[model samples]
Target: MLIHLAYTLTGDRRCAELQRMDSERLDMSGYAYYENIWGGGAESMFRRKASVVQHLDRLRVGEHSLFEIDDFIVNGGEGPGQQDEHRRLFAPAVDLNFRRFEQDRRAYLEGGAERQADEEAALMRWLPHCRRKLFFEWNAPELVNRLIPFLYLDTYLSLLRAERSTIEQVRRDLVLGLNRAFSHLYLTDSDNLYVTTQYLHSAEQPRPLVRLTIPLSGVDLFVDGRPDMAYDRERPDLLLRFAPPPALALRPGAPMPKLERWRLNLLTFEYLMRLAHGGTYNILADECELSVRALKDQLLSAFAYEPAEAGLIEFFVAERRRYVLKKIQIDEQGHLRSGG
Candidate 1:
């Protein structure tokens, strides 16, 4: 029926041939009905085929006619208008089947079923490649866009067996992973834009400015000087800030570490503080070649790592500063005593 319909909609000889071939292959008795309806008169068949081919070329997977085909199967060929009734019948079955398949696959993998795991992984990988080709050939941007949401979903699913972590922690990791990937693609100096001639001109221009008001908590912490302010919400707020570079721009591959490196240094300091205290702070400062005051200011502002904290934070800052001073031999070299 679908083949005949496709043939009728598209006067494509290929579609008509496919209908005939499938009908013969299936050995269905209904082939006669299709022939009588569509293969009778030359003008009727030609006109119908032309119309059907044109329509079929425009057919999208989720559009109205698609559901009609599914409905036809579910309701045993009662046809178009009965879609609403059959949809209710089929929807639950499809959902249940998908859920069961996922559960069974997970259970098999958990039980060390290597063969099943390999098979499932192979099938999953094949599906995306097939989908990409279909979407590209059909020029279906909507279907392609639908696939984008799954990139993160798939990333999370891939990490399902990793060390158990709280949902909040996992969510944070996912956000960081996505941010890293996006930054690499869109913001990195060696990104695709730099290599492509078409994008090189655009790359030379500064990225468009984005304005974001600091959160009340952030404002209270920095502007109001409240170090005790902690976020109570499960999700951390993301703030994007921009610092326009100096007019004497550094060339590509320059040694300058930029703001991202500063942010990373602050995070590293916070992590180290959580792990230990009473270490020589001078070591860290010297390693990064940062003055004590500059390092302190950067850590405080970038990560909210307060030196006033009683235990880990204060101990960490003091020890790190001492370590920096000693390692660089700042007293003998007189390097740390002077400004850069």
Candidate 2:
């Protein structure tokens, strides 16, 4: 769907870019060399392409609005009895600027600090544009719901990896910003749980920790009554603490190890995956504008961390880029509906 839409809307430029991508893939060890867990064989590709073409045809003939097309793509054309493992789980098109940012970030990551300035420059230029497009220009609320979380995550990662003395101040601002934004987007079941990445320490263990803390008075969510339990204990009902997985744990009194930025991202994502699976954080959809349940479903689908593989982290980092980019593009095109 994204390929067809890009080709249709952007014309020769998109076509040239696709051709160039194909050429680059061919120049690799082989086409398969460029493929990953998120990729499909020719048959599956053709099947998706065909379905998207049909949807595009409908749009061209005024049979459906861009929102309708977006609905079909994000939700799929399946009925209740037809549910399958391959069901659509929050697939949204991201914008061109984000697409390029991913490419540039990858290059910088692989090439080391030499390209850091370029990557940072690109993000500074595009973050506002992408935000504006998602918030104001785009009308696909479903897609936007699935996407903005990631935008926040990526922005957080960028700030974390930056070499600056004001990082703590910036991080606090990010957390507060998330609180302000998510307060409007999500509602809890008498449990105000606001989840985002934070860097803090535990008294019992002075290592990097992923803590979930809720500050309910009488509700002992942990049930164990262990004061050492560093779960969500701030103001939310459940506290989920995720530390560096055992394999990545650091030694005592060691200098702060420089983690690969995406590793931090994957750890945070893994924590969210656990939260989504537990079904403890109940988001009231009717009470809010965004379908956060759908967002969680998408998060579960996109970042399922268990049943791990060798390069799962790498695959997820790449897939995250594509998923966000697709959602942005879909939302941007929502301006096309004459009455919608």
Best by lDDT: 2
Tell me the tens digit of each residue's lDDT in model 2 across 1-340: 4654344344323456657865664321112211211122344454354555443222122112245333333233356632231132211223332235445434544655876787667544534333333333345554444433332344344344552444434333323322322332222222222322222244542221112222222111111122334444532112222222232233355333231111223223323332333322333222221333343233233333332222111100114232110111112434422211
Q: How many residue pairs clash in each candidate?
A: 26, 29
Off by over 4 Å in 2: 1-30, 42-162, 185-340
**TM-scores for candidates 1 onward, in order:** 0.18, 0.19
Decoy 1 TM-score against native = 0.18
Tell me the whole-model lDDT of each prediction, alpha carbons only: 0.30, 0.32
- Model 1 ranges off by over 4 Å: 1-13, 25-244, 247-340
